[model samples]
Target: MSAPPATSPSLVLAHPTLAERKHTWTLTQPEWGTALTLEEYLHREEYLTTVPLAKHGGVTHWILTVASAPPDQRPILSSCETLRKRALYSTTAPPGGGGVAEGIAHGVGSVFTDPAYRGKGYASRMLTMVADELKAHQGTLMSPSATAASSAADDKRLPPVAFSFLFSDIGKKFYASRGWVPHPSSHLSFTTLPSRRSSTASSDAAAAAPPPVAAIGYHELAELCTRDESLLRDRMSRLPSSLEAHQAPSSFASTPPDASRPLTYVALAPDLDTMLWHLMREDFITTRLFGTTPSVRGAVFGHPGRRVWAVWTRTYQAAPPAISANTLYILRLVVEDESAGEEYLAEGLRAVIDLAREEAAEWGTAKVLLWNPDGEVEGLMRRSGLTFEAVEREKDSILSLMWYGDGPGENVVWVAGEKYTWC
Candidate 1:
């Protein structure tokens, strides 16, 4: 009889500890880029030591390695991270009329495989392991309160998490094969700035026209969070109800039978303390990336009581035309004055854009990209004299928002005005 074929090398999943941080950092550098040095990365970790997500079991990190790899070769094959947060789901019941559920949202980023190990199925096996971990952790996520718990238990008896989501730059079909479906409810828009000559002319004419009164002012992210915690929370709490009535039905809507209701939705539920910590962390990253002082990259505009905030970041889209330059990204936008309606929100957005434009000019970029803005917000962008074009969905390498879960996965929307770039 022929000798039995040698068994294939098994892959092992492990979490990097403090001792292995350098190794982990080495694996991520090529994918995350050279702007962030190992020292800066370590500093960021030290600064976020108290961030609520990690403290409360809200985030987890993992790495995969080939158990049988030779000692001389690097064993780490791939890595990813997940974040857990309290996601709110709307209900028809009274008393605030919404319920809070925990979501172990899988970010699944920094998925890099060693070049020598590519085509050997390491990435695929690692993703399968991630899916298994998410499924196992689903039951452990908690409901917000006794009431929400009862409501969730009474409904579909769904898993603790409504869904796990990831923003995939990789091909959609690649993730699809791993059981992730593109979120049809979300889309991206890109706006090109008017020529520099026209913009400069307009600025000079406005300057000559009048000594304009500053009705709206802009402040740093930390200061806004400090001064407007309650207002921010109150405004954030209402986003789900507002979107349910206003946003058009997503093409991907399935389940719920009701076309109007979202299949899955999320808002930033960070408490006052958590928000401050998050902003500080962002400031650190901004300073490192732009060589500007902390908090200079983001601003909150409008009156303190009725405010809008926008954070800026540099991004590169490596699609057609191959842009590898600075592109201003609206990292987060929020309108605090709910009763003021879309027009007021539009005005606030415009003010923030003006500030962003100044910064963009300084950085020598003429392109701006806005993440998933609801229908009302997009309309406001159009009315403000900015022409926006939808980014075509790609089978692979589109900014794919894919989710996995039983509860309204297709209908889930992002309501929290803030976007976590680190996540």
Candidate 2:
């Protein structure tokens, strides 16, 4: 169907307040699909209402509706949530050793259009409205001094949205038409077949290996929340600088061998406090939504001496192609000390994989999926005897990582370590 007239003043963009949450919830239920139970929906609603981030303005949800419809018929046409964050973007410096340049980014997710309203351009209109809102907000934050020159400089120095991003189910072309580009990254999937060999052989080989020297332990979110803040803070502070790089600006001259080149990459760099808050909030919501059943759990894994950590949650797969009935999604995996080397991170990952396999066996599923695994971790997983297969084209769900505003799309590479998606 053709889009509604572009100039129609009857269209309304709104951010529903707490008083209108019930109405908003009802509108969203259809978008969430019939797979989610009413109890699950109520759990999500409660979590959204209580999360500290919402109160602090770190997140906001938006909706679009027709202004002329009667109060009961003013159905929400499209909806999405925006996460405000200072994502880290980096580019290699010119040859003589200037470090990577860094900048902030904004993350968007959970975009949905009412099924009955699809093909009418509601989603596109809502996206445009959200982009405008973000652009204006970024302008205010980047230029508190508010000088014309500063504003002009901000326009040139930053992308139209500073940095806008979303994971698209609609494929690259759909988003590309709206000026968003796919992130340069790869997601890896691995499957472990159930062992048919007898338990005695497996037990005997394990007894022969020197007591599995690496110390691996899992702690629930409740326990992690009580751990000393200084530990996590120090770990976050010590992460590598290259992990966060900005795209190179167009004006920079090509540096010869002597000048340091710019490092180009996209990353989310939440501080220790923010990271902790995310863990607690995610745990609160997922536990209630998925329940305390054996199929799901929210926890963190730590290696010997607490030198490395990874956060993850195991739950039943709800998305399509049925790759597996159960899956473990890694939220963030970090090495507090880079000097620990790939082997160290590899060992931590292997432990997590082992745990996942054990859970999968118990849950009767055969595969594990990792979204947007970066080169380093991907290499380690391969080295640890895990093989990857790209989701078959016919079965693929079109997981497109699209970005908008500022910097050339080619200069940015989205890595998986810092960001977390509940699904």
Candidate 3:
């Protein structure tokens, strides 16, 4: 008779180490979407140690750890590369209050376990540990990147617990079992954005929270980016625009990369190759924020994390579209905390335009081409000598500050597999 399957907890759980390469399993990120490759893991010690500090303004690390080892040899087991985006978003004011939008919101970017180690408790343990890190410090909120299904519990003002995962993932069972719940999804929609919860508030939860800050290594950020060069480019490249759209429109619940296989996988799991793409189509991973390096980020918007309303190109298939007199379009700019400054905003508007003109001149462009703003952003743009040109879309009053831009927030696309688990 065959041996029966081991219970989930039977799997071994331990800190990942380089020595465990032979026993470790893995998941590799494919070029696009969320394609993963599972194999004998290597460099098991690279977990958080090798993480590169993203230049744009966050911590980008590939989470490859040791879930468990073999039974007889107890081979040290390593797992796949699961991308984790852990940014401790902070401001002078507290978050969700009327202050300067201070505090920390830690996103798990993505988590992937090992294939050979799956079905055990490796993922759960890693996740729990990571969550603890997020929960540390005062003024910190536990907004995990859950699948759409898992996000159903908490208030939407909190980050989406579901991430882009469809209601199908139903991962809330995991977090819920641990005391967290789904946040609202309605508030996350493009339209009907809710006013940001004030950043200043006094509560026990706030008091116990860690000082929000997933500080990135600026040195590393500089190493991984191409910011200055972008000053010469045109419109920023958009994922949906560059790659093919989904055949059957789906919700963020899908949580995988787009059907087209994203060049970058915003993986939460170990194996990037296994996660389905159609799910993560709406994910912010492929946007200017998360996936692109610093150079690309700097090239898209003069500032990193400055989510633009829209962009365009004069010709050619690449991004950083050429800036030219012939090319004209209206745009929208939404600051995360408009309350932060009235004078500063005015100053910023002027600075952005002046900088743009300087770059345009360098790009051999003349005239302001065409520019327009529908809302306050229009006024801000005009401050820079820009004016609205045409209508991209029209609708009765539009929702304001729709996204937290990177516009590309981090998210999990896949897990290495049940094999990587260690309970």
For model 1, what is the error of residue 276's alpha carbon versus the real structure, in angstroms, after optimal superposition?
6.4
Q: What is the C-alpha lDDT profile of model 3 across 137-206, one tens digit per residue?
A: 1111111231111221133333322222211133444544433323222110011111112322435556
Candidate 1 per-residue lDDT, tens place, 1-423, comes to 111112234666655444444566665665664345767766665455446554444455566754554322425666666665444444334565655444434445566665655666667778778777676443222222211112212433334554455656665667767766664434344544333334545747755432111322224445654544445444444544443464455433223324564434455443433444455555565566555533346556567667776666644322213334546666666666656766667666776666666555555455666656766777777676655675644542333334454444445555543344335
- Listing every candidate in turn, what is its Cα RMSD in Å to the true structure after a full C-alpha superposition? 8.5, 8.7, 19.8
Model 1 spans > 4 angstroms off: 1-10, 18-21, 34-59, 66-74, 91-97, 101-104, 135-162, 184-247, 251-262, 270-294, 314-324, 338-343, 363-366, 392-408, 416-418
| Model 1, TM vs. native | 0.67
Please provide the root mean square deviation of candidate 2 (C-alpha atoms, Å).
Answer: 8.7
Candidate 2's residue-wise lDDT over 79-112, tens digit each? Answer: 7777655554443334643233334455666677
Better structure of 2 and 3 per TM-score: 2
- Candidates ranked, most accurate by TM-score first: 1, 2, 3
Better of 1 and 3 by TM-score: 1
lDDT of candidate model 2 versus the reference:
0.49
Question: Which segments of candidate 3 are over 4 A away from where they belong?
Answer: 1-13, 19-26, 30-110, 120-122, 125-180, 184-296, 299-423
C-alpha lDDT of all candidate models, in order = 0.52, 0.49, 0.27
Give the Cα error of residue 370 in candidate 3, in Å: 22
Give residue 98's error in model 1 in angstroms.
4.0
